[model samples]
Target: MKRPKTKSLVVYGTIAAILLMFWISWAGGIVPQVWQVNALLQDDPMLQEYPYKFRAVLLASGVATMTRPYDMEVAPFDFLQVIEPDLAGKAPNDPAMVAALKRLRAHERRAARVAVSHTAADGVEWVLDRAWYHKHGIKLPPKTLVY
Candidate 1:
């Protein structure tokens, strides 16, 4: 029987280590215990006011026609629906425009309000905007979605 070479052993060990690191990162993602809150929000830092922001305000601000209540605690996310677009390397409003439109229509009754935001960083410019809900044939509902 022939013995395995030292170089071959070293190469195989290095590859195994690399793959393990990747698996650790992927599998541990999303669990709060293994994830950071700031890490998630900071991932998208745009300036435009979010539609959910408006929706939450309406829901918690004493609902225009209801008597003031003391138990309303607004959730962290303002809207039940959020449409985030990633226009990273391709042209703006590419084939993904249709998907964007569909996202807009998903929770139509929630809020006819759409918010757009854009941020520029590291020599890259980003633009995000949502059309008016009513204009899109969608209406804003009272309670926002939280998940």
Candidate 2:
């Protein structure tokens, strides 16, 4: 049988090298994904109490996970209440949504501060999606349960 050419050998070597690198990274737990975040965001049971607080907790988690994205399985949400929508950019918040978010943030801050100072003092957080809010119509936040 004729031997393979050097060109074929080189191509095989390159493919093998790429595959080896991918395998090494996977074995070393170097790949980070959005699955865990989605799970935590979806399954954080305490989350049912405070809506929008989820956004803040997630923001905080993002900041915290800068070092070990792969090792980071799940983290809390943050910055929901403080979020300022950029209305003029590509992701511009609709005018009505921006106004609504600001109002919601204000409400969260007011309620949280009051509950923290007078009752728990820890200030619990909560997150509620727009769909859920409209469906169930929550009158209060997560902290209110503790109060």
Candidate 3:
């Protein structure tokens, strides 16, 4: 059999490279968005307390994931609100929900302060503080969580 032409090989290689790049970009972008939404939803105290709402939010997230184009920019919370507006807003007029929200906010504030204080001086202290926060599930502020 005759060997393939150089032109054909170049065309095939270019197509393969394009496909690989697309796949890499799609996976890299979408996976983090999904994880971010999942984390935010799971860590929400109100969602945990309300099973139906949790299911609804998860379903909406899944739909958003499906409909979202590869590598498209999307704010996870914004997509969430498009599906269920209430999920993004303040809790309903329930005392327990309000208390839970307050507690979560307080925890977030404390974690932020601790992270700021430790990270201000040395890298070693920052690492140690991060490890402690993770071990304790302190849920450090979003910026601190990145390292």
Number of the top TM-score candidate: 2
Write the residue-wise lDDT of candidate 2 on 1-147 in tens digits: 335687788899999999999998786543232233334434554433544433222223223121110112211111222233332232225565556455555554544443333221243444444333334343333333434
Give the alpha carbon lDDT tens digit for every residue of 16-76 in model 1: 9899989978864333311222232234333123332222111111121111111134211
Q: Please, what is the TM-score per model?
A: 0.20, 0.26, 0.23
Best by lDDT: 2
Each model's lDDT comes to: 0.32, 0.39, 0.38
Model 2: residues >4 Å from true position, as ranges? 1-92, 127-147
Error of 1 at 105 (Å): 2.9
Using lDDT, rank the candidates from best to worst.
2, 3, 1
- Candidate 3 on 1-147: residue-level lDDT in tens? 335687788889999999998998785533443344445545666545532222111122223221120012322233223334455564444464455445444543333332223212111110122333354344444542334
Q: List ranges where model 3 is wrong by over 4 Å.
A: 5-10, 19-93, 107-147
lDDT of 2 at 87: 29
Instruction: Please give the distance, in angstroms, between residue 84's alpha carbon in candidate 2 and its true position after superposition.
Output: 19
